[model samples]
Target: MTSTQVPATPARVTAGPALTSAGLVTVLLGAALPLIDFFIVNIALPAIGSDLRTSSATLELVVAAYGIAYAVLLVVGGRLGDAFGRRKLFLIGLTAFTFTSLLCGIAPTALTLVLARAAQGAAAALMLPQVLSIIQAATTGERRSKALGLYGATAGLSMVLGQFLGGALVAADLWGTGWRPIFLVNVPVGIVGLVVARRLIPESRSRNPIGIDRPGTVFLAIALVSLLLPLAEGPVLDWPLWTIALLVVFPFAAAGFVHVERRMERRGGVPLLPPSVMRMPSVRQGLLVGVPFFIGFSAFMFVFAVTLQDGLHLGPFGSGLVTAPLSLAFFAMCLVSSRLVTRFGQRVVAAGLSVQLLGLLVLIGTVLLEWPNLGVLDFAPGMLLCGLGQGLAMTTVFRIVLSKVSPEIAGVGSGMLTTSQQAAMALGVATLGTLFASAGAGPLGMKGAFALVIGIQAVLTVGVITVARRLPDPRL
Candidate 1:
């Protein structure tokens, strides 16, 4: 090990030299790509459905497939990055993501697009964890804090920007491509990222690399699939026998995963995720706050997109334009989030959540008042408030979650955080989406459905504040 590197573990110390400005930008670009893709399809789903002749059930798969695959394989992807070089994995993943995106752009049918999207998600899983692990390995102290804050900024901006970008691309209909350009646009960006990353990014890997945990990986996959499959497919399929069976299987599969992981730990081997990591007070409590926050955030994005286009009769570009103020607000706040954290400690997250609830209340009131007569301007105030709140909460929560992670397990820690966030996002689409659909189709109509979903999100935002109170103070 290099004498200059910090001592992180008995076997593997942090390997890379301090990150340069160019290297930091490369990794942040890599981080932005996957997050942007996660929501990029939200504003394009209608176009995809019309062009591909897909039913609503199949349309849901188009989104759910990417999120599920991404969530399921993330930890394993991290383990691979640790065993191999992180830079190598990052390159491979970016290449594969580029190819799969091309596949998605050229997909001949709805099923083909769905399958390609899942492949794209798998590529994202392999790529995304390395960004964080590399930062943890290559930077320290103030540099690490700045890098993390940029990552947070990148992440927040990407989610909001995805919808905007998708809308503009779909409306542009480049060469009459319509919805296809959203996926295709990544190809050029991926190519540029690859060139920049290879030149600027340093290669790093764990010194004491362990074998993959085959049993643990299998059990974890089963548990996630069993749980996510039912929630995503149940409403679409009318709660069929298979969905019920999978739901029943989920608990047992989860228990088996926990048992196997513990057994692996006792035998002096690294499991996919060591129980000790989850047992950490900061890690555990921080994830609790993240779940409800992401769930509400993602659901709001999905439902609002559909409502804006289908119910309110706005075009894709018009719908996306409505969110411009939110995106602007989020971007501006993310730039200042590090300063906010320095000043307020963990209270920033609480304050953010409180503001988000206030914004939701504003949105609910606006919907009730304007209803069928709503315009893009009507959503401006509430969306701006929500964005500011999200920026404050999202950036700081990421800091809090990884605050105590040592460099030795940076890959696994990054994987765990991403996995939790992705899982919650997929669940949000399933549960809240189903609620929206069911209630809309009922006598309550679209207006009532929108009201209920926003109300539920407000409740979830409150849950975030409750959990935030339990987090160890970041300033400490």
Candidate 2:
């Protein structure tokens, strides 16, 4: 490892025992679970709905309930970690997550599964922010950056792996559990995480940990729920009056959240997010890149899974096989991207965007050309390129977003970034996925819908590149 001095900031000056490699691994393992669970359900949804006799709308809730709860609670979870302790919350969240997974696995009804999924998401919110907070508090400079890269890799890998693994588990029908095994598998993993985390992970909290910013926390939750809830469930419910009311309230809620947080910060009370942190050019521009990138990334994944299965008439495992290259390529590319970032600075994101756009174009062409004949072998090149590009963009943005954050509010900063990401994932699925569903029902059909979403994603990539060029160059 390259030698680098710890930051001389008082937070670092009084830092605890240097974080062990094992500790970092343990926390990162904690990070992987929520993300895995998030996408794992996608492939298993049909199985879940079939077995449970659920309506299409209820099945969609199985996904959205988790995402909405996870997104809303993330910032508060971070604040609690800062005020109490990261390790404590990590353990608490992990334990809750494990039990919730079991609850989901054994759920006998659609409502039961939805509730458990929401609970699992809440548990995840508690656990995830601590992963980033612990890294920011326990490590500095190059070590911190490397840890963040692994976190990013774990994240990107989890999305693809979740789909693949879920397919495998459902296909295997281990003990005839079908979709249940996808969730049950997390129990053992979470138990191991809890055990190792307790032994290896060092406890860390903010040096000047502040009390919960109640107003900011409340408003933040309201804003996110108002926005995410409608987007996630609106189309499924035929865009009801409540959903419309929430959508109308979303802007006012968000503005109120910002106003309250800023007011709290000016009073010298640490808000959920320090307004100053948001004002940083790096954080601002990095988030701009992240919003669309994640929206496109997630929308593409959701749409691809559906197209591979429903449109192409492939089984879960067959569809997963088609996408597995994306995961593998992403993992391989992410392992090396930190060095690329160290060399090329912000331009790496631009380059990654170029590659991602190429990959999207290829995917569009292949789908258009192959249509009914498209299969795993045919998807290899575009999938590989897409994953490589995603790995680069995701890892780079993870670092850039947190680069300027001071350690004192690392939990809050990390929380904000993650919340934005989770919210975007939820929103993308709601909007882009809705668009696909709508288009699929029209004369255009499923292949046409797939092409439409992919094309829009290509446009979104260009938007990210445009914003990326304005970002402050990396200092490394």
Candidate 3:
């Protein structure tokens, strides 16, 4: 049905109990794939490198390629969903993602794996935005909040579980598959999701949908690719001249894309990003705040994993165990996020930042105090606090940013928010991760490198608090 035409309330006949339950599970399954893929490959990276004789540089590409491509195309993916049908795009994206996962599992060379990962990222861009849009359009008020809470919980849990699951799968070497199980495992999950989705999820789309803004899409893609590619690859290659050149062009390309979008909107044409949404203070501010937070978060996860595995002589499962407290705390906080947001308003976010900063400081202290004696148990308390802070800040931002958005613009709004998040995450890994890697090479070693990284995170936390002050007190 068109977005404007609300469907009749489901009767017992059309949406059977089994079908309804299947629909919810299908969307959750869809959401789980992209997140699961992200962290799952991380733990499996060392194994893949050993088995394939791939260098560290190429392995980085395997991870970064997927993130960069996914970040760049998310907005376009959302617009496609609005123009065609969310269900249609979702199905196509899911099928492509499933096939690509197979390709990644069977890849004979590092280059092939990287290329397949890029395609997988593109498919994820198309698939993920539709999940939120579908949920938003299909539910209202309290039900919406509940669905979003579930999503937040799933996201947090999946990231941690991805690591553990990857470790277990690799260790198990199911049928002598070794690291290949990381990708191969998705086959069954995707198949189940597809079958359930086809039988259950109803079709949805915008009425009076605008034609694709081809020029804007092209420029935006170029802008994002130019910006993300260099950062992700520059460190691996030790900052090549071409990488520097791309960095210089990114801003200009981004500006040109914005100008074209504005012109299109003025001429009574629908732009990929509607101008009105940009005008909303809540949306703009939330995005600005989200960038730094996600950047810090993504960088922290990447750096920590590497430090634990490489510097501390821990295995994949050990590294995953080290981070388990953070995930557990995050999940616990998210469960109460709705109530907290309702009671404390935006103050909860500010408090979260403050708490996170404290946690970082404590962790840093432990690093400095214990030095070479530090182990996963010693890190647990601080990591749990960090996770709590993250839960409060990130989940609150997700709700506050989208709370004011209209259902008509839901697809693009979700795209914009998610793209900002993904872009910031990639940037985090590139910038802060680079800093950690570089510092580790010096006399300070891993401890010194970690201290520097946490210092940066502390600074970002302060920025979050400052931004939180500027937001509406009671929140929406």
**Candidate 3 regions with alpha-carbon error over 4 angstroms:** 1-19, 49-58, 136-148, 274-276, 474-476
Candidate 3: clashing pairs of residues: none
**Highest TM-score against the true fold, candidate:** 1
Clashes of 3: 0
Candidate that beats the other on lDDT, 1 or 2, i.e. the better one: 1
* Candidate 3 lDDT, 1-476, residue by residue in tens: 00000111111111112224457678877878888888878777778877899755566667767877786677767667766777788898899899999999999999899999999998987887677666655666677677766766777777667868876887778898888989988888888788878878777765555466788778777887687777766876788999999999999998998899899989987666667777788887877777898888877877776677677767777777777888778778878877899998878888888889989999899888987777879999899899899888888887777778775555556656666677677677667876776778889898899999989999988988899877664454
| Ten residues in sequence with the least summed lDDT for candidate 3 | 1-10
* Model 2 Cα lDDT, one tens digit per residue, 1-476: 00000111113223665678999999887888877776678777767867898644565567667867776777777767876888899999999999999999999989899899889988987887788678877888899888866776686678677868978988889987878998999999999998899888888876665577788778877887787667767876789999999999999999999999889988888676678988888888998998888778767877886777778978778877887887787777778887898888888888888898999999999999988997788998999889888878887887788788776555556667766776677677777877887788789999899999999999999888999887777763
Measure candidate 3: CA RMSD.
4.8
Ranking by lDDT: 1, 2, 3
Best by lDDT: 1
* Candidate 1 Cα deviation (angstroms), residue 208: 2.2
